[model samples]
Target chain A: MIEKIDGFAYILGDDINTDDIVPSHTLTMRDVDEMAKCTLEFIDPTFAKNSAQGNIIIAGDNFGTGSSREEAVYVFKVLGIKAIIAKSFARIYFRNLINLGIPGIIVSWNESIFSKGDNLEISLNEGVITNKTKGVKIEFEKLPNFLTKILEEGGILNQLKKTLKG
Target chain B: MGYTIAEKILINHSNLKSISPGQFIDCNIDLIMVHEQLGGRIHKEYEKLEIDYVWDPNKIFFILDHWVPAPTISAAQMHQDCRKFAEKYKFIHNFGYQLDKGICHQVLPEMGFSRPGMLIVGSDSHTTTYGAFNCLATGIGATDVSVVFATGKLWFRVPESFQIIMSGKFNKGVMSKDFILTLIGNISTKGAIYKSLEFHGQGAKNLSIDGRMTISNMVVEAGAKFGIFQPDNKLETWLVNRTKEPYKLVTPDNDANYENTLEYNLSEITPVVAKPSNPGNIAGIEEVEGIEIDQAFLGSCTNGRMEDLRIAAKILKGNNIDPNTRLIIIPASKEIYMEALREGLMEIFLSAGAVVGNCTCGPCIGGHLGVLGSEEVCISSTNRNFKGRMGDPTSEVYLASPAVVAASALKGRIADPREVL
Candidate 1:
């Protein structure tokens, strides 16, 4: 279950790809903990250094596009990013994140209103995001019922295991 | 009722008759290839299905590229998994760090694994590069790959075809990279989603086999199922030199109908780059010149061809890379590496203070080598320059042609290849 979190927002522009989320160089390391130390080193080195665990990421269109590298999704999960709200997502990335049990919401309207460091409250179950600073509230289109069930089960792999075993 | 090169191949191989868009039907896969990274997962997934042997090991090709020579223990584990899988299944083609082992797409055609009128699937997105030979190739998920392993066939929706015809001649310093980027800009990235793109025109004949591969390599970025150019004597000659197997030639019928047709005059094309955040966010090199860059990379299945090396070498022959720049060269395959050595392109790059690395994908994926630091800016030849693409979210990556990357390496800033060439 996703809980409402009041955290600082890191506003990113459109098309934040998987490569930027996780560098390919770190793929050499097997430990997710060690690799997470350098997450977002290209975009903000301090991101890995100073980021509080479970920060919320708000982005524009086409998030997680480019090279279906699963490591890209894995890095964010390891970095403790709570939820990613974007206007839209690349098809494979959306699936991969859901499979990894990451909460990704697609909010089509008022995406530009939220900026960096805004104190935002998100309710995953309600699909509502309220920006207290801007006095704006946005409703995200929830994942389909079937996908919600998969996410609840902790990812597609776990879901698959359960289904196969049952 | 029109058929594209991708559609025709799918129809001929379709288990059912007369398939259309949105209707998925199982069809046999002519080739199932995987690299070190995803191959291990495929094997593990296969184990879950309790499969002793793959449907047709002969048609499956496994390579230890990507993180090969094992950059770390995890990467080594991936290789180990692939090695065991290959041995257990008796897969016909298993390549390590030796000769014939390179980027799957490059070595596949170089060793004649791809042919006209065939359907190929790989775990990597650039698998569409095989479509340059008029084959239908696309990437699939790991579970889907397991399904393909258990059965020789997987299902696909018949994609509509978009015909792109290019005429006129290319301007000086313009390359295939520019032409393809121009199309992405014109059509938008998702403009051709789930469609096969067929390139035809007198100007296409002007491109070499390697150039054609570079153009088709990034078809996935435009959300297309694949991009293909009809085969000609150049492709046939290359295939004949590599394999002795009988090959078939296929093309769209003279009256083949297309859902949409677009024409480009090649002469109007200029050196282009996809600015940070999106591949479709394109601008000509002239528009962004003098933007300082911290890195320059020349490799990837896209621009890592022998001809791409020659272009970069020619530009860097006597010029030194800017002290502020970190330039790295990754040849697509071992064959390209040896050929570059024989052609003295390696010396030119080395003399320019550039680091020449092995045939594996390096900084392109932001893996081991060439990780960009925060606030750094890079000009690279690899497809895709989305935000945080090369390392730091603060660092920026600009995608361009080999010549542009080489020129940028020399100047420590994004540049027009025409200035150096």
Candidate 2:
């Protein structure tokens, strides 16, 4: 439901799969904080140790492939990831982000534009991603108006609640 | 313009009749399936809403799978929660632990609730497996599942179609699993990303309903929204005795527009494996043949069917399992387990010194049973060879068809099934 957020950027590479997002063994705890400790530990052993709250993640194409585990998106939500901008997203990952009310923006791949800890800004309504550090901008294709309404409601749960009451 | 199978089904179910790829529309859901793991989460949300019964209990089904019989205290609690919810709602249910007939994907069809030209959604990615029967199925998260429960509605952005044309025929000991794995190898993991894969061509038509399932189950590994085939006599025969529910059969028009059309000749299909850490990281069996493994797993939503068990049994008969390897056979559902037992496939597995696990996902999700220890190497029929997929991240997972898995178990190496078959 909350929109127009700005944060520093965190960059990860292509096909950073579900296992890397949260290992299967760590799923015992649903507490966001407890589960967030293992975030991306499968691939980057140092990620959990280095996560910064309010940082946005910019990923390469096919981000969040493998396994339909939502922990991948859950940890980021807990960590307060401002938004995610990717060249492309695996279908279920994109769906999970929408259901969770996370801003998932798709942009064409540009290696020269971003570096870890860069200044990033997204205009959700306009579908534009700007890298302030490099002074570059990319236009993203707009999502359907229906999904935009859900995201504006801060995820599907709130949307469902409203629908049920009505 | 003509429409693909997925588009046709989505259009029919949506509030509107005409739609295009990338356009979002709300549609009525035909079925909602969930397991204990997800059902527990949905229960919490359902309570939070304070609803009066469900919108339609008959449209929903619960399965006590994913750590069947309760592998841990928490798992037991989750299963109990699912059971309690099912009891309160009196929804259609299948508990593998009690009746030995669960595994939502396989059981739904085996029991015949799913049908051609339907819009199905589940909380598990392998829900796409239902597409083999020509239905449009996809996976979503717990929150989405909860929404569907509150209202029998969900929204989808129609996906563009990626048509895969499979022609020719299977080689000796080669099956749909092998060709599909090979196709994944060539396509890479993200090749299909958000698109739907509509399978066609003579090669696909020649595959048994079981074999088509093997192909559809892993389409998610290639980043596909769904994988499906045209309805055939094979599926009709399987369904004739199971249900009399009136349903429609949908086929894409010949002039259907495709984002891209990929053609493959199945006669050239080779035995392959998705090396550890990636399902798309494939290599020919000859390249990795002599590599030894610590375990061999033959089951998952991807393979654990009667045909897969029969394939493994056909290769394992009389030949003992290599003492160096641990082979675990987990049938997909209770019906498959019972069918295997009736066919005497269980005796062969026992004689081969394989551990016959229950009708559950078992170690595929690393929930329990057959978990690989650190540094262990495993050849499996399960989908997704992601890092630590079967157990330890340091351990290696090789994705193969049941034939290769069975043969490798007998040889203690990644040998092709043809060597033994």
Candidate 3:
């Protein structure tokens, strides 16, 4: 299966910590819509309002560092983030995203080539990323079979659900 | 090729006879620690599983410390949900909504749940703190933990191991916190992402259990998956009375394969602080000295043990906190709180104009207690210094050892601990 994800890029800088993604104070709120409003509120007050559905997050190193608050990733899920491409990611954050069936990609950062609002096309099977706006193609290491299996199955919960049914 | 301690522990817990980094393997979890997230963030995913009965009720623990005393009505409701869940699942180790129990990381070990050669997972990031006992412990998200609750098993992509060999003794006022802060500065926060850090050498072996816990607790700051120590007499002796569970000490083979090795002589390290906005933004005492602070915090899962309290008391006994600065002290667990009270450390703190609060993660996560105001600067002994971690995003935090936090509170600025000690 040639799984592909394409979306407009939303650029972010280095060390976009979990606190910046989903501030601790907002964790008490039960509504996903209310929590999504505060996504990246600390780093950019307009992020939640401006971000469009199906937008991909392109970031610098150490994205989603600090705190194991899955709400940080949950906000992105709620914001309709299609995929996350970064130079690196914190271990727990990356794991959380993958467990939730979100595509978290790590690439060697090229600051000059990718710009905000650039159209991006990611091929999960081919391990290639195409910058549609700039006409540049970059390759990345594909996720391992087990991880892709989890993603294909619509996250660990669904996988577990299937196993339980079996 | 020999396996690292992390590999050995993973292999011990799993059915695999041989394991290496990046290979996904399912391992039986020895312990699962839960906090408020179990009722809140984790509950949503847990319900998806639709499994009413846990795999093993005895294997799980619930400690409500993050929002202890429930500052908000919503938080109080979450506490109610947690109590109902515990009752439904028959979790025997549930600590309930007790105000005295304290942080899960500290309280779990004190209750004899953590042991060497165990695979422990918690919903909180600082769950790595249990690695001080040589356990292959790491943190995971709510969805992952939800699955563990039903199966008593979790998967791991065995992390590549890094060797941190420590030698020599720490200088006065320079403690494990200084060593870890300096190391995090040296190896940027992203340096150890997806890697396991195994502390070794004479200096690591010589550290008290409290000091070792402090080191393991902050490994998450450097993005390390686990910060395990080499088990030795200190841990073995300490565990003698804490647990009756017999366990073998897992150690790396003499020729264990390491992704990288770094050596440090503790004597050469001095008191350091992580400047505002990041735990990796390290600055020595001289570099950040005399920077005025509005508040000083002396507690967290990172440095809230009895040893940390004693270090603060030594400097605060005869001195009053600066009138302009507010000081807050919280012990990590009820055991540590009782110990501090018995040792008269609580008196020194109270007489020094410091507010001694019950054990809660308040203020650390900006949840409650003594939150900071905008533009305020605080010197804290807590682990993280991320923006708005203690309060408003505009407020700044300087991370230091207990000695530095105590001395800074007295001077109303970032002060050198050596001067007071």
Candidate 4:
């Protein structure tokens, strides 16, 4: 698992839902790459391209609050979004991110102290996220060992694969 | 302190004799269902696991809903993939569109596959509907579902229980949908995040099975993990005719600890509606009355049942839908459709100028049957009114009960059901 990491940051509003993550209108799609390009297009238009370099995303409460579409996580992973730090998240969306081995950290941050162009560092070991631009440190509940192990093995599938082999 | 209904159910489902909220535990799933759209994602994840076979295929339900009868070529292919997976695994619980089970939420309970004192999960968000039967059902993501398919187990964080001690009697025209709408409006969509709403008191007992299902199914919209009612005679009768398996009913202890309690009186609630773009954007019927509408939909897992159809039919039997507006009625399942047919509800709808469709979650997800165009507006019985929920982003959807949908259809705009009845 990632003990610490730093990446560029992006910000979003409260109640950002799966529909906003990926609209149901065109969800007949299958390819992750194509779908990744279409994500948040209604809101950020260029989010897909900007996310390619593994940018970090910061958002307000209830992120991924609508729908149980796992594609929400798949698209984020494919687009190279490294991690998400939010106030609170819908349970299914948070689980989807963890199951896919992507980081979804719930933490408290002052949006005024940070901007989209800023940088943030997440330390999974210390259970804290530091806004490198403004040097703001926020504490969070570190994930349990079992969940951390799933992320360490690059998702539950890989872990399951190892279990099967053993 | 004693255990709440959710805690009791979780304890029973888990190997543990007792459990507390906030503890993460691995528990076996009593029923795990996948609609075609979610099944597509689950199948992909299952293949990624490289598992040769499902852990327990019989326990899984391969439901051919969401895009029933294949809306397009690609959708047809998705169903085809699910069918092949079910056949290859010899999973006998598969319910194809042709089987007429309707939506999985409606069919699963009607067929007695969803029993009380069990833990159920599904890839679709509305799977919380099974909580109506006193089962601990919740929506799960593709990853969790894939894990369940591989091991028949998934990890869960036990949720705190929030009590709703409901009382009073509803007005004649008021239904359970009205009560839930009023509650959602008061609590906001995310008010009950990650908590289970355990309903009790006279109001909960007065509701029928259908009413209970409507409330539980929409808990996800309120950001609640579960909306449950203690198993009563209404539920007992519903299960007695359907279930062959012996079952046990669990209820909250008298001194059960709850995170919070909110009391509601049935008489205080009015016919309500969730306006365009958000389920939480709610208002009384009078506030939205006379808003122009192009369509009125009466279906989806939330309200697409025989009782829902009967409610709509009763108001429209001697009336006609507005010529400028279109009305579409869908029974939730094949069995529901048959029951409505036997009851002449279908005749009432057809005679009232509404198009009665088969049992499918078509227009609600913007799948098919009656999708809206730009600038169009609809009053629908289904849950959720997010942007482009039924069609173009420019289109608008107002969520209400089946009675509201029927009343609005007759007036070509949003109308209070009480006025019509």
Error of 2 at B350 (Å): 1.2
As for candidate 3, its clashing pairs are none
Q: Say which prediction, candidate 2 or candidate 4, comes out ahead on lDDT.
A: 4
Worst 10 residues of 1 chain B by lDDT: B37-46
TM-score (chain B) of candidate 3: 0.99
For lDDT, candidate 3 versus 4, the one ahead is: 3
Predictions' DockQ, in order: 0.23, 0.64, 0.82, 0.68
Off by over 4 Å in 3: none
Q: Which 10 consecutive positions of candidate 1 chain A have the poorest summed lDDT?
A: A156-165
- TM values, all candidates: 0.81, 0.96, 0.98, 0.97
Per-residue lDDT of model 3, residues A1-166, tens digit only: 5368978988888998998898889888878799899998888888888778338999999999988889998888878888999999998999899888899999986767788889989999999999999999999999988889888987889999888778
Give the runs in model 1 whose Cα sits over 4 Å from its true position.
A1-16, A20-63, A70-166, B97-100
Model 4, position B30, has a per-residue lDDT of 82
lDDT of 4 by residue, B271-359 (tens): 88988777888888889999989999999999987768887888998888999999998889888888888998888899999998877
True contacts kept of 4: 0.56
Best by DockQ: 3
lDDT of 2 at B94: 42
Which is superior by TM-score, 1 or 4? 4
Candidate 4 has an lDDT of 0.85
